[model samples]
Target: MPETNLPASKTSFVKGFDKWNIAVASGFYNQKIDYMIEEKKQELDEKNRKYIYKMLTFSLLIAFILFAISLYVSTYLEKYFLKYRKKIYKEVEKNKKKDILLAHQSKMVAMGEMMENIAHQWRQPLSIITTCASGMQLNKQLGLLT
Candidate 1:
């Protein structure tokens, strides 16, 4: 290097300029970093919102499907119960008719037995009355009724 006569004030001014340049560059980088951080935060918030919306949609779809299936099952059960009820009613009616027929047959048999007993009771009384009347007629014909 050649020997040059540089003033102390000029050297101090150069040092101040370097410090000012470094400060300006650091401020610019700091501002850029802050902007990047804000953008990243906004992106994360948007993603979270979308995720929540998708979850809500999926849940609603599942609920609707469950509701539909329950309705179908209820309808099927109602129909099945109704069909069985009708069949049971028909069977009950048939059993009632059979019971009535059996009761009528029992009554007829009891009446027949009662008639036979009545005929047996009257037979002896009728035979005694006929014998007494015949004796009275024979006595009157022989003139012994005076």
Candidate 2:
């Protein structure tokens, strides 16, 4: 074997040192990549949280607005219903008075009709009585009866 300027053991140590340096650099690079990935994930989580918060706030605001509108509409409708009910009550009272008047008028008409019928029924009996009295007086004058 020919002898080189560098010893064989020293050359082997140099080669092994180079390999260890490469492995350390690779490990550092891998750690940096993992840190970057973790930072990106945190940023995404923060953005999602902000989006969810905005959505929840908007939903609550819309719900409050709808509730206020419904309350106003319901109050307005309730007042309108009360006014209408009062008007209906007045109309019902007027109808009741009219019904009573109509009933009184019906009774008056029925009484008038009954009085007329009674007068008609008595007229024939009164005429027969008058005729019988006159006949008795004439028989007495002619001595046909004691």
Candidate 3:
């Protein structure tokens, strides 16, 4: 099975996280590892308890600050999006206008070709009409064009 990046909330983690510790909400994500180390230290004899506890506390504090900084960054990005959203929208419109102009140029070229073909088709008939008119005028001058 593929390893999914599901949140620690879904998958099992250390006892601290399983108990819904504040560290998880603070978003350090590494605090889970700290808690795991604490759990392993639980099996140790005596000297490790205070040290592990201090480590967990330090990890929690760092995680909280990291989460706060992350929140600030995300909020900054959101504000930037709000500020520049209209400019991005205008760029999209400009690109669309350019596409439409290109399409129009292509259509005009096709239309010019179609018109040229029509002129060519009509050229022979027009010439025939002029010739017949000239012949009739000559006949009339000879008294037969009426």
Task: Give each model a TM-score.
Answer: 0.58, 0.67, 0.46
Location of the lowest summed lDDT over 10 successive residues in candidate 1: 7-16
Q: How would the candidate models be sorted by lDDT, starting from the highest?
A: 2, 1, 3
Q: Report the lDDT tens digits of candidate 3 across residue range 89-122.
A: 9999999999999999999999999999999889
Best by TM-score: 2
lDDT of 1 by residue, 45-115 (tens): 99999999999999999999999999999999999999999999999999999999999999999999999
Per TM-score, what order, best first?
A: 2, 1, 3
Give the whole-model CA lDDT for all candidates, comma-separated: 0.81, 0.82, 0.80
Residue 64, candidate 3: alpha-carbon lDDT: 100
Best by lDDT: 2
Question: In model 2, what lDDT does residue 10 have?
Answer: 21
Please provide, for model 2 over 36-146, each residue's C-alpha lDDT reduced to its tens digit, 9 standing for 90 to 100: 999999999999999999999999999999999999999999999999999999999999999999999999999999999999889789888889889998998998987
Q: In candidate 1, list every pair of residues with a backbone clash.
A: none
TM-score of 3: 0.46
In each prediction, how many residue pairs overlap at the backbone (N, C-alpha, C within less than 3 A)? 0, 0, 1
Query: How does residue 61 of candidate 3 score in lDDT?
Result: 100
- The reply for model 1, stretches above 4 Å from the true place, is 1-38, 127-146
Per-residue lDDT, model 3, residue 127, is: 97
**Cα RMSD to the true fold for all candidates:** 11.8, 11.3, 25.8
